[model samples]
Target: MTQLIFINLPVADLDRSIAFYEAVGATKNPMFSDETAACMVVSDVIHVMLLTHDKWRSFTDRAIPDAQVSAQMLLCLSREDKAAVDATVAQAAGAGGLPDPNSPQDYGFMYGRSYADPDGHIWEVMWMDPTAVAAGPEAFAAHDLTPA
Candidate 1:
């Protein structure tokens, strides 16, 4: 059975968060969305749940750390290629996210960039060459993911 990942984040504005996620290529699953929570599907196996503070509290009593100033987690999503990674970051930025909050990573075979949503949740988009990944990390000496 394939395991699925559901990253739940607390958002200040559900509507805005939904819009931002949609811009970044996540489609909202109406079947699991409501006024207090939105289930944004990134792929067949990945889903992001944007929850209101009230809704979040019902699930966990722990204080919700302000993602704006402090990062709770760095969520990453894989793209098809380097261009797709850049495109996702650009889309997030166009939707009001702060681009490149973290330093970009470029290994030629593996490229990545990040953007912070309006609530300051960071999402990293990455692309990796399948051939390079199969060869492992030792294959890249200086930004070369695959050995020629």
Candidate 2:
């Protein structure tokens, strides 16, 4: 069986988070949703659990990091091509997210950009050329993922 990933994140507002993710083309899993949390189905193998702050606290002893104050996590999504990555990032930005100013890296095989959601969760949108990576790391040298 193929491995799957479920990323659980704490959200300040459940409804707002649901709207934000929906704008970016994700669907909610009604089975796991409630007033305190919702399951976002990114794909068949990927899901995100968005929990209200209070509900999230119930599941963890560690304090939830204030997204505006400090970094907590970085989620990344891969695309089939560079254009696909760009489009997705654009959609995220249009839906109240902001692009990160960090430098880009183009290893010839992979290119990526970063963005932050309304709640300050960081995400990296990336595209990779499998053939280039298959050749070797040499293909990635000096490639800037950020625009010139």
lDDT of 2 by residue, 1-148 (tens): 9898889899987888899898788999999899999999999999999999899889889988888668866788888898887788788888888766345556556788877778888888888888877868677665654556
Q: For residue 117, give model 2's deviation from the true position in Å.
A: 1.1
The TM-score obtained by model 2 is 0.86
The candidate scoring highest on TM-score is 1
Instruction: List runs of model 2 lying over 4 Å from the truth.
Output: 136-148
Off by over 4 Å in 1: 140-148
What is the overall TM-score of model 1 with all chains considered together?
0.90
Give TM-scores for every candidate, taking all chains together and pairing residue i with residue i.
0.90, 0.86
Candidate 1 lDDT trough over 10 residues, lowest sum: 139-148
Q: Which residue pairs in candidate 1 have backbone atoms (N, alpha carbon, C) closer than 3 angstroms, thus clashing?
A: none
lDDT of 1 by residue, 1-148 (tens): 9999999999999999999999888899999999999999989999999999999999998999999899978988889999888888898899999999998988667788999999999988899889988888666665643423
- Give each model's whole-structure lDDT: 0.90, 0.82
